[model samples]
Target: MMDQPNPVRVGHKGAKVSWRKSSYSGSNGDCVELAELGNSVALRDSKDRQGPVVSVGWRTMTTFVSALKGGHMGAGQA
Candidate 1:
């Protein structure tokens, strides 16, 4: 299994996070928004802006994105 960083709550630290959606997202509303919070990054469903948020370290977020781009992450074969 892949190691993952523990999620952090979006408290006062991220109360004012400026979230942005990827330009690749379609109008289907199956997209997520990302916000940079200093050393950490926050992610939330774009359709549910006030819903739950997942927070992880900046390095972890970058690594995860790289893995996704390289097709190293998927449903199985961890």
Candidate 2:
């Protein structure tokens, strides 16, 4: 079996990254941010800018976002 890419990958040695927040996010607070770097997508908490980053593939990210919008992944469930 091939090794799958990890969902989380931390940047080291001062790599330049451009972060962006979701447009659907509320102004009050509480949102998730995304950053597209090459073929990878980075996710981070809006409240905590300096928090841990989770990196995923573009296709995987698209599927996850689509599922989220389609309500396929409900709360309180894995």
Minimal lDDT window, size 10, model 2: 1-10
Q: Give the alpha-carbon lDDT of every model.
A: 0.79, 0.76
Please, what is the TM-score per model?
Answer: 0.77, 0.73
Q: Could you give candidate 2's per-residue lDDT for residues 1-78 as a string of tens digits?
A: 322456565566788777788777788888888888798888888888777777878888778779888889995577
Candidate 1 segments whose C-alpha is farther than 4 A from its true place: 1-15, 75-78
For model 1, residues 24-61, the per-residue Cα lDDT tens digits are: 88999999888888878888888877688887887788
Root mean square deviation (Cα) for candidate 1: 3.7
